[model samples]
Target chain A: MPEPVEIGRLTFTEAEIRRFAGAFDPQGFHVDPEAARQSPFGGLVASGWHVVCAWMGAFVRAHPSAADSPVDHPSVIAPVGVGFGLQGLEWKAPVRAGDTLVFFTQVLEARASGSRPGWSVFHRRNSARREDGVEVMAFELRHMAPDPAPGRG
Target chain B: MPDFFYEDFVVGEVKAFGSHTITEEEIVTFAREFDPQPMHTDAAAGAKSVLGGLSASGWHSCAIMMRLICDGFLLRTAGMGSPGVTENSWLAPVRPGDVLTLRRTVLEARTSKSRPEMGLVTFKFELVKADKTVAVSQTCLIMIGRRNPGARLA
Candidate 1:
């Protein structure tokens, strides 16, 4: 119905990139700046995984209910749902240090779950783009939420 | 480092990686900063929900898989970068205290028609729990360098 909501914005820094890389994805091009410069990217580039992780962080912070909420426990504007699956994940472009990204998510569909009597499944399309508007990553996330309709469950 | 290039990956070869045990603390911490759904952050709420108990977010599972892959082989391989993911499915929920391991199979390998210095390798990845239950399955492509001494991209 409405245009996709703008979730949040994030800028990648070398240190942040390396910190994530060191912990989860320590590829040479991801961890060593000098080695990365000599690698195919010609400089340090955030791992696709790192970009996805940062996107999650930004998405959570910018969530509608996250306003004025504490970092650990935010106001529950909507019921938390179970993550089911993801579809069509495309890392279209490289994310380098210093590049800022904007995130967005749009609800695609929501229907009652036949297997889970009290729950509804929602499909959401999400994307992250650079300041230049080049897309870095896109995907469809499927999750299940409690049915909101009164007496429906 | 010796060239573990495009030639090294053989079709049908399945490689298993290290494992990580999911913990309740990490699940709540990650969900608090990322997914933050009640089922993930609130234990009592989660237990009352369909999941029956607290569970790890699917994205958290992806991060764990990536860690195992990096530690298993990507760190020492002649890897370029991946174009994107074609398929990613979470078949089962990952709960705290579950030990998960990653298994990868070389599904396809072909030289890049446009970039001679590199090749494309498609892999089938799965996250299997301690009881041999697969929680997540993914198929994706990676760009890898060739073995030729003068074929380095940088």
Candidate 2:
């Protein structure tokens, strides 16, 4: 098994939370501070989707190889691909404004795709924790990447 | 006082709602901030990718689905938020200009044993194209407050 990679951190600012939520979610606890204070959360909270998007941003930025390679010719170190799905996505704790989250990704398994030629499927566990070390979110992501070793497939 | 509560969700009920047309500008804007993958952000790069063309990030599609859900029924219900999604799948690429709609089904509804004030409803949500192609499907559990606590407890 490969070592887990620390994808880096993100600080969820109030403005960022509100802007992202306003454009996509618009839930009371996410978009409006006053309305959020009256909601069950009792204060503005970042949308779960926003947190996931932050993780993705961090992950992609951490691997600069993805940006260097063309789509048809993927980097061996960072074979870019699209996510097929996710499972067991859990928001264990609320992420409030100003909370800094540290993200990590661990590859669980990888196998050549049976359906798609020259493509490999990766199952990875992605997670985020607050600066205090409390786990806040977790999910298993499935994505397809170009196989580094083509003839083997 | 929400219009719908835990007691209102019946198992096996199905409903369809939403009509969102994705735009290339929005797709590029969203991708530049989040995914940033070539297939999602650059048209020329996307044409060279296995996806065939500029496609919205899968996360973008999920966000769109959330907006549809909020507008369709969640905003009117006594929603307590969701713990997590059991499963989610992107069955097809969500290209720009695609008219997406939502199809929701109540797979299960059960009162919480520990939290009597709320119930858990399992839902299967599908983001379908205008032509009936399902682009994304998700199964998740949501917590909804009961209209009256312990009113139906056996």
Write the residue-wise lDDT of candidate 1 on A90-115 in tens digits: 88888888999998888898788888
The digit string of per-residue lDDT tens for model 2 on A106-151 reads: 9999998899887789999999999999989999999987764433
Q: Largest TM-score belongs to which candidate?
A: 2
What are the chain A TM-scores of the candidates, in order?
A: 0.81, 0.85
Report lDDT (Cα) of residue A38, candidate 1: 94
| Model 2 accuracy (lDDT, Cα) | 0.87
Worst 10 residues of 1 chain A by lDDT: A69-78
Q: Candidate 1 on B1-154: residue-level lDDT in tens? A: 7347887889999989998998999899877866777767778756765667888877888888988987888777888988988888888889999999999999998886588888899999999999999999999898888887335442
Q: Can you give the lDDT of residue B93 in candidate 1?
A: 82
Question: iRMS of each prediction in angstroms?
Answer: 3.6, 2.5
Judged by DockQ, which candidate is best? 2
Best by lDDT: 2
